[model samples]
Target: MLPAPSSERWKPLRAGLVDMFYYDQEEFWFHDGRLLLRGNNGTGKSKVLALTLPFLLDGDLAPHRVEPDGDRQKRMEWNLLLGGKHPSPERLGYTWLEFGRRAADGSEEFRTIGCGLKAVAGRGIARHWFFITSQRPGAELRLLPDSRVPLTREKLREEIGSRGFVYDRAADYRRAVDEHLFGLGAHRYEALVNLLIQLRQPQLSKKPDEKLLSRALTEALPPLSPGLVTTVAEAFRGLDEERDALRSLADAQQAATDFLGHYRRYAKVAAKRKAAGPRLTQSRYEQLGRDLAAAEEAFTAAQQQLDEARGELTALEEQRAELEARRDALRADPAMRDAERLEQLRQDAERKEKAARDREDDRDRQASQVRKYDGRAGQAAHQAGTARDKLAEALREAADASADARCAQQHRTALA
Candidate 1:
């Protein structure tokens, strides 16, 4: 008897509502020997092909369970099968096919073949079947002449290459096909499939034969010039230095980008302060100068007035002394002892003397105040004037500096 076929399994790649796109369910199958699929247009035919891909690759289709609707007890079912020789004795060797149908109550019913194989092999020791599809009838099925064929990754690569197909990432390519063709209703999928078929056909290798070497020839090669070698090395070194510089520049640029976010806030505050500073300084300086000048003038006038009052007080004091002398003389006289005349003369003299002394004392106090006020006002005026001048000078300096900075900035921008 012929050796048993290799063990295999099928798992669902994708599944969806059959009634959504079409009135009937669509399905596909991939056997170890052939690929079989059937569906009408707009009936999720290509969708089934996409869904079944993982299953055909012998990968887990329903490795984890997912609840359907709110039913936590529901188990995720896969549309896959196992076929060929049994890997273990407890399981059957053939893959059984199944389909899902919608019930009247909006539930699904799974259908399956109880006995007959989904695909059959020819009656021979080297029997095998390869199921593929094509728009053309005869072109769909390809038969292997014998069972001596060995499949390998390199062989598959070569086969795919011959047919003008490339399987870099099978999953990605399948998704691209499904999305571009089936999902989007474009012809790109059909073109891709056809291209894959063309590429899968066998072809001869084009690599050159390495066995034909010339062993008889023996020759000495000339030495390279030291100068030329040094030049080349220097060039390489220069290139390496340039690459390092570029990497450093890139790092700096990234750091600058990060810092700019913080810098922007600081710059805004600084700009506002800078804009207000000059005008404020100028106004303060002008007001301070006016106040200083006014204070100084008032203090000088007070001092002059105090000096005139002092001179007037000195004259009054001299007059008071003369009157007191006269009163003493009158009191000492013999004739002054006469009652009415002596009393009237004494009273008149005392009154004049007291008035003169009082005027003198008031004038003296006023002079002292004038002196104190003059000193204080002069010092205050000097200080205030100095401060005003300094502030004005500072503002001018700042304005000049700002103008210079703007000019420098413009120059720099121009150069850049």
Candidate 2:
């Protein structure tokens, strides 16, 4: 009996979709290990697959949404290269796919994968890259759409390596998708997924013609030999010049169309102005004439006012001259000049009288003080003269007593 598959060898299935096109969200579960969607024309099957076109081609989430979702929050859009329209000039919306392994126990193990396109501003394009979630429970499979961790080339390589989706930038994310999903070393898995989309399309998956089916089969498989790829690549090399020429022609055509449109718009405006020029100039001339008439009226009134002002000024000058003559006559009057001199003489006499009164008062005060000092001096002299006479009489009496004492001493000596 064949050994039952172990969990390590479990196949990864593309289980569900969320926020895809107008469906907004749709979930599916495995039925006999397969889920098929069917509808008539104009349903969303093509639109849903278009969302996966970027990833099937090269693991891009597409640069935008494949179809409009009424539930989408952002309004911005990009003219995407791969497919879809989405917001963000850089870092467009994330595309996520969850891979799960179903078991008989009715339990499914899931590993969620999501990525975003990074805008290359200089190139005016974007490229696909993996996202490490910014929210904690760090960069695991399941994360909110908006949650993101800053990641770049080497950082992403290490992350994918750790996630068992090892890759290099040369082979890029295709290898990672193959490794993580199909356990393949090459990117045939991506090409196969693209084939699956076409299989669902009524246009490509119609009633099979035998030879055409054979051709499709050949295209489905990768070339068995490296030399086949080399030959194909060498043949494609010759087409590069033609492609570049076509691109250049397209660019030239676009530029010429833009220039012609701008020139036409400018010419229309110029023609309108030319048509209006004569009327505008005539209206301006009429306005200037009105202004000129008003100015001339004002000039005539000013001239009359100036003449009246000159007459008033002349009268004022005559009045000033008469006042000057009156002033000169007053200056020459002898009576007026004498009255001025008499007033000066009266002021000088009053000043002299005031000086005489002040001097007489000062002399009277000094004389009174001198009399008081002289009376005190005379009384002191009289007392001193009387004291001297008393002293002189007392001295004469002392002299006589001394002479009597000396004579008595001599009489006593003769008696002895």
Candidate 3:
């Protein structure tokens, strides 16, 4: 197994085919960033590699780039239609390559890039679309709803949804894939694709043919950009012209250096002759430096005293501010007197309410006593009426007794 190209960056994880060529659905996984197909010719190894690698990256259905033998006769449409072996009049297929990398947090991330081809029996390639996605097919994502049937372009687009984009144009698809996978611009990625195609040729290392090897390398090598070449030539030309002027200036500088060397010797001798007077002046300067140092010490002491005084003044100012704040607070004490007056009024009102409640209780008791006396007076009036009725009956009985006795006496006299 080959070592991984890089540990941090994404590398090819697998290539897949869906209803393309002889594959219903298949995957070819890479081991350590490399995959080797070990099968005899006619087993569709080259076809598998051609469809997945440079073709998937570039979305180039050109026969030369899509085929290992550089055969212009072959077409991707034929692969999709299975070279007319199928009974259907139309067909669609997919070819994809998955790239993977280890994240910093030890998780796995993936990107899948592929092209969808639609082919008609006689109309060649009807339409094609390319897709790039972060979703991994056969796991989090599915390119085929059923095990055998591949997804259509519309379904694929819906399936990927916001996780990816479906590209209508090959150039746009190539740009997206290049930016996501290779981190290269269009021109450089094209060169890289060309190199990949050259390296993937069928007979790269089978035989010791120097001519073939030379041709492969020559084709794999990117052609020098004309603009870049011109820019480099102009830069070299300018440097070459400047080199002569630089050499002339260097010669003049050497002449000036020689003259300066002689003048320096003369200057040193004159400096020695002038040193005695300066020595006397240097002693005086030292004395002045000591005096200046003493003056600076005095100034620093005064500055310290001034700073201490300013600090004391700041404290006094803060104390004054606090005193003013207290005075302002004391000025608001009249409001407290008003609060006390309100409290007094509230207490008077509460006492008056208590007296009123006591008066109401006394009135209720008096009304209850009056009601009791009225009941006793009604009983006495009823007794008096009974007594008067008894007296009238007694008087009537007495009159009747007297009348009966007189009647008896009259009857006796008549009998005599």
Q: Give the winner by lDDT.
A: 3
Model 1 alpha-carbon drift over 4 Å, by segment: 1-275, 328-334, 364-416
Q: Give the alpha carbon lDDT tens digit for every residue of 338-368 in model 3.
A: 7566476446545544544544454444444
Candidate 1 has what TM-score?
0.28
Q: TM per model?
A: 0.28, 0.35, 0.57
Q: Is candidate 2 or candidate 3 better by lDDT?
A: 3
The sequence of per-residue lDDT tens digits that candidate 1 reaches over residues 1-416 is 11111222222222222211121233344343256556676554443433333222211123221111113332112111112232221211111133333445565433221110111222111111111111111122111113422223243334323222223343444443343223422344444443332222222113333331111011112245799899999999999999999999999999999899889988887766664654455466567667767766776776576577667667767776787788788888898878777677666755665565566566567566656666676676677677667766865654664453354344335325
lDDT of each: 0.41, 0.47, 0.73
Identify the runs in model 3 with alpha carbons over 4 angstroms from their true place: 1-7, 208-226, 247-416
Q: On a 0 to 1 TM-score scale, where does candidate 3 land against the true structure? A: 0.57
User: Candidate 3: worst 10 consecutive residues by lDDT?
Assistant: 406-415
lDDT of 3: 0.73
Ranking by lDDT: 3, 2, 1
Number of colliding residue pairs in each model:
9, 3, 0
